[model samples]
Target: MGYLTCKFVRPDKQLFEGKCASMTLVTYSGELGVLPGHASEICALGDGVVRIKRLDEDGGDERDVVVSGGYAEICNDVVVIIADHARAADDIDAETVRRTHDKAQAKRDALPEGDHQRAYYENKMAWCDLLLEKAGAQTASE
Candidate 1:
């Protein structure tokens, strides 16, 4: 019935900015959905998908964005998402991610049990999996 002014951004660039009918974003606690008149709040972001429903009068217009880490603030029907990383599902090129994931997996495996860098590679691999899944290019995880 109303609209929300939404801005989805990362340090490098602004990914999405516009008005939408509704939006769902992942928080450290869980997925939270916001409509035009949502109560103002702030939440820590988590690695997951964001779903946005557009204000098309015809309806059924929607978009999904994969994001990892950051914060979201809502006030007065305006939602601002400052993400550490954000990418539209449609833009992912799964073939490239698959290759890099394999490399990251190899690097992670090479690390000793106590290696701190192992976590970085592990996170990368996990992110690759998420990207593959969100892009609908996922092959069953082995």
Candidate 2:
């Protein structure tokens, strides 16, 4: 079977670089699936989980990461994800995420309805929720 050269990078460093059989990720338009021969295109990424399936000598290996936001580019059977913020599900600190989520939720609740600051806090809480969900899913899969 054909494979894709996948690279995932964050502002601080490259998080992943390898070959994968397939990848699924969230985009601004919606969820997108990329295979070995996917058409070349560029898409704005959304906050969600990115799943990669890799094939090795032994068998298939699946990995997941939480991406806050960014862009994805595909070309010549190569896929690159440049994320604003990303961390492997296994690397996430669940306790830290929970604390941040609680703080953001509390701040949003204290603000008056329709306040602009509330939106910011709401977004932060949502991001934390996504991370927490991904972390839980990873743990359950183990």
For 10-53, candidate 2 gives per-residue lDDT tens digits of 99999999888899988987899999889999999998888898
Off by over 4 Å in 1: 57-60, 137-142
Model 1 root-mean-square deviation = 3.4
Cα TM-score of candidate 2: 0.80
lDDT per residue for candidate 1 within 4-120, as digits (tens), equals 999999999999898899999998889999999999999999998989898887375888889989999999999999998788877889899899899999999998998999999
Candidate 1 lDDT at 76 equals: 98
Per model, how many backbone clashes are there? 0, 0
- Candidate 1 similarity to native, TM-score: 0.86
